[model samples]
Target: MRAFTALINPIAGGGRATRHWAPVAARLATAGADVRVELTRSGEHARQEAQAAAGAGRVVIAVGGDGLVRDVAGGVVPGGGLMGIVPAGRGNDLALALRLPADPDSLAELLLGAEPRTIDAIEADRGTPGSQGTAAGGVIVPGNVYAGIDSVASEIINASRWLPALVAYRLAPVRAIAGWHPPVFTLTLDGVTSTLRAHTVVVGNSGRYGHGLHIVPPALVDDGLLHVMTVGAGPRRAVISFLRQAGHGGHVHRPEVEIRTAREVTIAADRPLPVGADGDGLGRLPITVRIRPGALRLIAPPPEAHAT
Candidate 1:
C-alpha cells in the first residue's frame, strides 16, 4: 500500500463521483491513505492514467462505477499491480456482485485490509485474429461469431423515461426491426457448435453483467474460464420468456439461452460486430475470448465478501 489516488469519473452516477469526492477523500485520508484525486476527461483516459502508474507501487482506487473500475483495473492486469474500486456509479455491478459494501466507510476499511489476489480476465481477438489487449492471448479465432454481433442481455439499467432499459428489454421486438438486425452467429465451446440469431452475446472475464444482473451466476473472476451467455432466437413471445429468465440470473436454463463455462470461446458472425467489454463497447466481432486465471492482483473486499 502506498499513496491513494482516486480516478474519479464525474459523469458516472449522475455526477456521484464529483459530489462525493470531498467526503470520500476525507475518509480515505483519515484512514491513513495519502489521498489524491484525478478526474477523467474522456473515454480511456482513466485507463491510460492508471496503466501508466501500474508498477509505481501505489494502490490506484478507481472511483465512479464498474465501467471506471474495469478501465482502471484493466491497466494493472498485464503488469500485476494492486487495484481497488470505490462504488460511485449507478450499478456498481462489480461491487454488488462481489458483495462489497455500497457505502464509502465500509469500502475504505475493505481497501485498507484487502489482501491482493489474482482475478480472472479474458483476451478477445478480431478480424484475422491477432491479439486482444492482455490477460490471456495465446489462441486464435474459432468460429463464425466474429463478423456479425449483437448483445443478448444487458443490465445497462440507465434511467430513460422514454424507453427505460429494463422495460425495453422486457419488450424487445422479435428482431431489431429498426432495420438493425443482428446477424445469425456461431459459437463453439469445447468443440460443440450452436447456431443462433440472437439478442446479444456477452463475453465475460468477470461474472458481473449490466446493472447487477449476474448473467453467469456461476462465473468466478479467478476461475480461468470465459462464461458466455447468449439470449435465444424467435418471436416476441419467446423473447419475452427469455427476458423473464434473464432477470432471474439463471437464463441459461432456457432452451433458447446458451451458457458455456469454457477456457476458450470462438465467436463468428456475418459482419464485423461490436463487443461490450465491462459495459464499454469495443471493436468488431469475430473475437476469440480466452481466460487468464488470477492474472491481475485485485484488492479484496472484506471477509463478508467471502461469506457472500
Candidate 2:
C-alpha cells in the first residue's frame, strides 16, 4: 500500500497551516489512504522529519510555505524521492509555477492520480571569498535563487508586525527600495566572469518569485539550465519602476535588464549581501549555483496541462 506523509510548518501563514492540514488529512483518511502528518518546530526539525518520511517510501508532501518547502526539498533531493507541495505560506511561487491546488478535495485527488515529473534543481555553494578549499556541501534550491534589494524586502516582510502578509508583500519592496542601493556584483557564468552594478540578481528555474512576479518568464523547470537575470544599476525610482513592470513580466525590455541562461553561475559582492532561495534566506553572497539535471521528482500535473 502507498503511504503519504505531510511535513507541515505549524507557524506558516501565521499558524494557518495547522488549520489547513486538518481537512486535507481528513479527506485522505475518508478516502482510505494511509496518511501521516508531522508539524515542524524548526528548520532542522522539518528537514529531519521529511528525510525519514521519504525513507519510508511515503510520498512526502510539504504542507506549508516556501521555507518549509525549501527545507523539505533539502531532505527529499538527497534520496531523489518523490515530493509534492501544498502552498500554505506567504509566497507560493513554486506552487504557482507548478499550478498546485490548495483546497483539500482537489489536492487529495491530484495526490492520488498525479505522476511525478523529473525536474532540474540548483545546487548553491556559499563559501568565503578567496577560499581555495571547496565546501563540503551546499543547499538544494528547488525554485529560484535571488539576492540584493529583494532580500532586503524579504527581511522587511519577515520583521513587519503592522501589515498582513499580502499587504506587506506589496509594500515591503517599496519601503526597501527607498533606502536600498545597488551592489557591485561579480558574476561568473559558465566559465566567463564579469562585474556589474545591479539592484538585484536572480537566477530562476521557474519564472516567478516575490509573490507571482514573473521576473523571468522564460524560465522552465524541466530545462537543464538556469536563468540569470540582472537589473543594472539605476536610479531608485527607475529600479522601483522596473520591479513594478516585472510583476507583469514587462521589465525584460528595459535596456538595463538582461535575461539569459546558463548551466553554472557564481556570484559575489564587494560586501556581504543577503541571499534568498525559494523565498527563504540562505545567508550571504559569494555563492556558486549549478543545475543538476532531473534532480527532483515532483508530483505535479503535466507541464502542458492547464491548471485546475
Candidate 3:
C-alpha cells in the first residue's frame, strides 16, 4: 500500500475543505492505504509539512483550494515527489484544469491506481527577499501567474471570502475595474522585448483562473511552454466586453487580445503593481516567470482528457 500524506487547510473556502475531506479520507482508509492527515495553519506551514512528508517518500495530497495546491507543490516538486489533489475550495481552478474527479470514490480509485503524469509549472521570481508562502525570492505556481488589473481583482476576491464563490468572483473584477487605469507594461519574452499599454498580462500553465475564466485559452500543463496573454488597453466598456467574451475564450479573437508561447517571460510595469499566482498575491511587478517543464508529477486524468 502506498503511504499518503494529506495537508489540509481547515479555513480554505470558509471551511469547505475540512467538510469535503471527510468522505475522501474515509474512502482512502477503506482501501487500506496508509494515510496521514495534517491540518495546515498557514501557507508556509503547508509547505513545510508537505516538504517533510515528501522527503519521507509519502505521496503528498493537497486537500484545499488552488492556493494550498500551489504551496504544497512548492514542497513536493523540489524533491521529485508525487502529489494528488482534492478540490475543496472556492476556486479549484488547477483541479478543474486537470479534469480531476470530484466524486470521492472515483477520486480515490484514480489516486490509488493512476500513474503519475509529469506536468509543467510556472516559477515566479519576485526579485526580492522571500515573503510568506515563498522560498528564497521565488514561488512555484501550479496554475497561472498574473499582473495588472487582474491582480487587483484577485485581492478583492480574496478579501471577500465570506461571500459566495460566484458572488465574489463575479463582483471583484467589476470593483477592480471601476477605479483602474491602463498601465504601460514592459514584457520580455524568451529574448525579445516589447512595450505595451495593457489591462493585464497572464502567464499560464493551466489557462484557467478567476474561477473558470479561460484567460489563456491555449495554455497546456504538459506543453513545456508558457502561454502569455496580453489584454491590451481599452476603454471601460471595451474591457467589460472583453471579460464577458472571455468566458468562452471569445475574447481571444478580439483585436486587443494577444496570445503567444514562450519558455521565459519577464514582466515589469511603470510603477509598482501587484502580482498574483494561482489565487494569492505574490508581490509587486518586475517579476520573472519561467516555465518549469515536468516539474510536477500529478495524479490526474489522461492526456486526452486534458486536451482543450
lDDT of each: 0.61, 0.83, 0.89
Candidate 1 residue-wise lDDT, 1-308, digit = tens: 45776789987877767665666667778877777778988655776677666767677877887667767765666545778777777657676655667666777777777666656656555444333244343221111121222242222223232454345434333333334565687887767887788756766655565555566666666656777777655554554455456556767777766666777777777766666566555555666667666666767653234334
| TM-score preference between candidates 1 and 2, better one | 2
Q: Model 3 TM-score?
A: 0.96
Which residues of candidate 2, in runs, are more than 4 Å off?
128-136, 305-308
TM-score of each: 0.80, 0.93, 0.96
Mark the 10 consecutive residues where model 2 has the least summed lDDT.
Answer: 127-136
Q: Please provide the root mean square deviation of candidate 3 (C-alpha atoms, Å).
A: 1.7
RMSD per model, one decimal: 4.8, 3.4, 1.7
lDDT of 1 at 270: 70
Please list all clashing residue pairs in model 3, or write none if there are none. none
lDDT of 2 by residue, 156-213 (tens): 8878735677788888888988867788999999999999999889999977888788
- Select the stronger candidate by lDDT from 1 and 2: 2
lDDT value, residue 157 of candidate 3: 92
Which digits, one per residue and each the tens of the lDDT, describe model 3 over residues 1-308?
A: 77899999998888988788888889989999999999999888888888888889999999999999999999887756889999998999999889899999899998888988999988888776665334565688989999998899999999998999988988988899897899999999999999999999999999999888888888989989999999899887687777788889899999888999999999999989999999999878889988889988889988765444
